[model samples]
Target: MNILEIKNLSLAFSVGGRYYEALHNVNLSLKQGEMLAIVGESGCGKTITAMSVLKLLSPNAQITSGNILYKGENILEYSETKMRKIRGKEIALIPQDPLTSLNPLYTIGSQIEEVIKEHQEIEGKQARIIAKEVLDEVQIADSEKRLNSYPHELSGGMRQRVIIAMAIACKSNIIICDEATTALDVTVQAQITELLKEIQRTRNTAFIFISHDFGLVHKTADKTAVMYAGRVIEYANTKELFKNPKHPYTKALINALPDFNSKKLEAIEGQPPSIKEEFNGCSFEPRCTFRKDICKVKVPPCIKSENSDVLCWLYN
Candidate 1:
């Protein structure tokens, strides 16, 4: 069952009195206990799409149309006051930079305990115990002693674990991890990914994992959405998408990954179009190797195949 759904979501940014759309009719859904990975290059609207779910877009960012439905209710209609209740308790965000998300002045335990007190009925020593238990659940060593330390005292991985622990403490049903492991080392990244998988299995929590790394997504995500120029060009089961990618952009991305046997990295020529740039047809037409005259004349509609949905005339 779908825990969260983003339907026909369109968003734009105002710049110097004019608006440029950043997202266009984007659609996504997250199933209970499933990890749905959104992968694309930087500035591909991956982060913006995830941020829209929490209604945490920037001041100038505007949602032009669409609905963000959580548990069959549209959260876009929720007032700030109502959203406040859902933000941390029911839905949690594990940001790219843990330091910025955490308060440097306060002890880690105090911060987490405050969340527990606000979301749950517990307080005082009880809240502290819950905080310590969650930290231990996230595999933080000497959880009691570490709780006394500030955010600056912990390593990058430990700080991320603390953030994850905060979500666990709140008993969040959904976790939005926006490049949560990007700052950590390879070993730490692997550990964090494994921790997320374990949490999903134990708690049956849904996840919206936004990242540019396909390799990481392949390992952790059950389903995958490939975004390009602010649009989801392809979506499919993770293994199916990797084994038989349908979209040209998705194929290029997979080919770009290093392989010992190939001894060659195929780089996609040219750069992705900026949001401000208007596209007459497909946004990726300029960079697409198999581009035809018709591809530059009109945008391709999504075509449903056996195991995937692709946005390209070739599929149509």
Candidate 2:
């Protein structure tokens, strides 16, 4: 069943009395026990899109139009009080940087306990017990000892596990991981991804996994959304996307990955366009290898391809 849904969600940021669109008609959904990965280069509005669900956006940011439906209700219309109730208990965020996301001043136990107390309303002795249990659940060895340890004292991977433990402590129905494993090495990244997949399977938790790593997304995500200049250019099942990418951007991204057989690397030419620039046409027109005259004159509507839903004239 669809647990979270984002439909035609458009957003913009107010900068110096000007509004620049950041997310354009964005749409996404997360099912119970499924990991839906949003993959794109930096500044493509990946993190902001997830933050919109929590209503944790900057004051200057504006949601021009859309409905962020959570379990069939439009959460975009939810008041701050109602959002607070669901923010951590039902939807928790595992932030990108473990190094900076946690407070160095507090012990891991205290931090986890605070979340449990606030969202779950279980404090003191009960919260501490649940905190330790969640730590063990995330496979952090010697959970009791680590509880007293400060964030600075633990390894990157262990700290990340603690963050996951926080969500587990709340028994969150949906977890939004925004580049949660970016700082870790390949081995640790793989481990964290596996841990998340395991959590999804065992807890039946839904996840919105945001990352720029295509390789990791293939390994971790069941479905993938490829964003470009704040739009989802391509979306498909992870397997189908890897096997047959319909969108030009998706194809370029997959081709850019390291291939032992090809022993070659291909870089997507040109940087992504600035959101500040108004786009009557497709934002990717400047960078796209197959840019057509029509691509430069009007934005392409999302077309249904055999393997994926794509926003490009090639599939039109």
Candidate 3:
């Protein structure tokens, strides 16, 4: 069952009295206890799409048309007061930078307990016990002792674990991880990813994992979406997408990954179009190696194949 769905979501920002669309008719859904990874280079609208689901977009960002449905209810129409109740409780965000999300002045335990108290109506000793339990759940060593330390005292990996603990404390149905492991080392990244998988299996929690690392996505995500120029160009089951990538952009991204067996890396030529740049047809036409004349004249519709949906002339 789908826990969250984003239908025809188009988002734009106002710059110098003019509106420039960043996301174009984006459609995606997350199933219960599924890890859906959104992967692309920087500025590919991955983060913005996740932010839209949480109703945490910037003041200048406008959703001209779209419906963010959470549990069959359109949250776009919900008021700010109503959204506040759902934000942390129903949908939690694990940001890219844990330090910025955490407060330095307060102890880690206090911050987590605050969330428990606010959402669950439990306070004092009860809340602290819940907080410690969550910390232990995230595999933080000596959970009770670590709780007394401030955010600054912990290492980058520990800080991220604390953030994950907060999400577990809330028992959120959906966790939006916006490059949550980007700042950690390889070992720590693997640990955090394993922790997420464990949480999903135990709690049946759905996840929207945003990252530029295709290799990481391949390992942790059950399904994957490849975004380019603010649009999802290809989506499929993780194994299927990797075995037979259809879109040129998706193929290029996969080929670019470092392989010890391979001698050289194949990098995609040219840069992705900026959001302000208008595209007459397919935005990736300029950089695509197998571009056809029709690719410049008309946009390709999303075509469903055996195990994937691709937005390119090759598939159409």
Report the lDDT tens digits of candidate 3 across residue range 217-258: 999999999999888999999999998889999889888988
Model 3 TM-score relative to the real fold: 0.98
Cα lDDT tens digits, model 1, 73-185, are 99999999999999988999999999888999999999999999998899699999999899999999999899999999999999999999999999999999999999889
Cα deviation of 150 in candidate 3 (Å)? 0.9
Instruction: List pairs with backbone clashes in candidate 1.
Output: none
Instruction: Please list the Cα RMSD from the true structure of every candidate, rounded to 1 decimal place.
Output: 1.1, 1.5, 1.1
Query: lDDT of each model, Cα atoms only?
Result: 0.93, 0.91, 0.92
Error of 3 at 242 (Å): 0.2
Q: Of the candidates numbered 2 and 3, which has the greater TM-score value?
A: 3
Best by lDDT: 1
> Between prediction 1 and prediction 3, which has the larger lDDT?
1
Question: In model 1, which runs have C-alpha deviations exceeding 4 angstroms?
Answer: 259-263
Candidate 2 residue-pair clash tally: 0
